[model samples]
Target: MSTKPQFGADIETHHTRFDVDRYEDIYVVGDVHGSLDALKRLISRLELNNDDLVIFVGDLVRKGPDSPGVVDFVRADPCLVSVRGNNEQKILRGDKDPDWLREGDREYFESLPIAISFDTVLVVHGGVDPERSLEDHATDELLTMRSPHGDGYDGPFWYDDYDGPHRVFFGHTVHDRPVEREHAVGLDTGCVYGGELTAYDYRNDEFRTVASKTHQDRASSKVVDPA
Candidate 1:
């Protein structure tokens, strides 16, 4: 488990990593995007033990039905934790809160760290810059980065050239399937847009996914290059 000083008011502040251990299995999940039913089904399939931990890459709200429900489920469950995604940041920083937001949801989002760390892996909502030390990464890159070159819709991606100290598991960029690289594993399968809700079992190195019901039909296809 992580110590205190996990979440900070400033993004540039280095986040405290969860040095988690003693779990039967560690499941790293992609963006749920408020697909609560799909998330439930995926959890049911895992048959997780009490000690088994699930770390979500974030985007637990917006773009689908049941955003409030998704937040409530994760908040109630002790085994589940998450990083803060761009969507969550939007809600916290926006002038207007969404109607679906309930009491205590903001605190939950605020509690999420920018990254979760295992001995050899790091989990973030979006990609990290391989060229910089983890402590030096900016908040915007950790939340919304897609291309390594710039915020463009074309390659090469952030992980394409990574030769890492720790393998990074991330989401935010939707792919038809998980992106597998030596140093990066992308699990955002676009669940809100009719793709599968995906999760990676870290101990087993296996992917557990469930078919998702489409809530938003626009841009439902795989993102080869960003759109």
Candidate 2:
């Protein structure tokens, strides 16, 4: 919405369906606050192949210029798998709704899943809350929750000490650019907030970035050696 986001406690709107495990070579992006132009530039950079599965870490709308455009792109792309971002969740749950969209947008935002738990990792918009079980986590928790003591592996997109086989990738916190923790990694790059939008190449363990047009945020993509 046009105002600052307010994530409410009720989370039933996110009780929708989701993917059990349907991605690989995942090209995950962080917090796209309606930067349709920047998103297009990043997508063009990908030159994605049919096998390159794309995962979006949510917050794909609001706070930027083109909320509707972002949704249109995500809907058109077959290779893309998106989770319900915190902003989208706010609209879906009717907590602080804004006129960011004209019409038909609510349906699109309402359709997104809360989480996509894979064999390797869990993909979410904001960090997952550790206070509840994976199944116990409400859509609100998955959509708009973050924890400070996220060093533990109780949830998907929060922890910094993930020692499991798969790595959790997400966005929402652009304060720390390219945070590489053991439990989870944040790649927001703050593109829409004058930060660069980042992409992590999992197979090659590489990072790539495209500068934002609206903002001057910058990030030099680097590989994090696995411990």
Candidate 3:
């Protein structure tokens, strides 16, 4: 499934192209769950080197099998940067406190920055919220927020049909056409949920996607009935 989406770019050139040179390297990925194989393959395909920058949308663990693997790669890779995903946030905040999980994963997440922003784009697990200031949101706001506020539009951690500008890019909403809102783009693409994982070239508005290998709606649901 391929989708060429845009935010406030010229409607005439919406499908054609836009002046996306505002960024340095590719804006890269928004979020990736435990799809380690897919993530590795994607990075290889992109030819990611020391120069390029990768921004993860969040949710690096909790439902997928390679949660630990993903964390290790992100932490070690200098080019790969990530905001807190909902699952990561929950784990860091001691949400479920599952004893079966690894302590390193929890510590890694707890140590992550709240959000990532740039002159040309903004990145997060949820996205930015206009209702409140940046400091108004707690760490959990960096993840787990759905569309339409907490009940509607909370800010920072959400994606939906909201309209504005500033190109608020984020993930968390498994959506159609990356769900363009204001000046934002959502690339969560539902990678771990049997959907494609997409990475956008924030530099020129380009994108690369990696297909799922099996039916995994949750992190641990990699089994495809032996098909």
Candidate 4:
């Protein structure tokens, strides 16, 4: 692993890009939220290989038990990549740092990219701006955005207005089920709230989900917060 400085709000100026053609299978996962057991079960089902790429939509910590375990598991393998989520940004921004996070964890989170592009798919922790190109996307919108409209602009979900050719796969907004739109797909099935942990196979356009085995008491909290 490379040692990089812990970035602050200016982290958006640095981004990482990857070429999908370099891997055989590319799997994108939704908000993990520290459900290590669920994530393990889901990975077991995938039967991943050396050439496979597992990209997490982030929120790897907070709101659930075993956050450190999740971080360790992902960091142990080079095939796994995670985009920074709002919860991660909160931690990186010194908003919330759980006891589980240890030394060097901040650097790891700071080094994470805001979004990842693979072929025609763009994976992010949150939805992107419909009006801006991926390279010009605002870091705030990519990390914390929920609905599509803002500032008194009423409209449909962000994906509904997406006219880009690249399909956007994201997490952040929890749904009872995965939300599928024309150019976007939401996989944050609220795993931290006792919902399913979802993963999308970009190679086959298929989805796999593992029901939450822990934190069932938090199920009711999965509902979207009122705007």
Per-model TM values vs. the true structure? 0.89, 0.75, 0.73, 0.85
From the highest TM-score down, the ranking of the candidates is: 1, 4, 2, 3
For model 2, the stretches where C-alpha displacement exceeds 4 angstroms are 1-24, 130-132, 148-158, 161-166, 215-227
Error of 3 at 197 (Å): 0.9
Q: Against the unseen true structure, what C-alpha lDDT does each candidate score?
A: 0.83, 0.65, 0.61, 0.78
lDDT measured at residue 3 in model 4 versus the true structure, 0 to 100: 20
Q: Report the error of model 4 at residue 141, Å.
A: 0.8
Off by over 4 Å in 4: 1-13, 151-155, 214-227
Output the number of the TM-score-best candidate.
1
* Clash count, one per candidate: 0, 10, 19, 0
Sort all candidates by lDDT, best to worst.
1, 4, 2, 3
Write model 4 residue lDDT over 1-227, tens digit each, in one string: 32221223454355555677888889999988889999999999888999999999889988888888999999999999999998999998888968888998999998888877765577778887777655555677888666546622133457667766667788887777887777888888889787899998878989999999656364354454322
Itemize residue pairs with steric clashes in candidate 1: none
Clashing pairs in 2: 59-85, 160-182, 160-183, 161-183, 162-182, 162-183, 191-195, 194-215, 194-217, 195-217
Candidate 1 vs candidate 3: the TM-score winner is 1
Note each model's CA RMSD in angstroms.
3.8, 8.3, 9.8, 5.8
Candidate 1 runs further than 4 Å off: 1-16, 220-222, 225-227
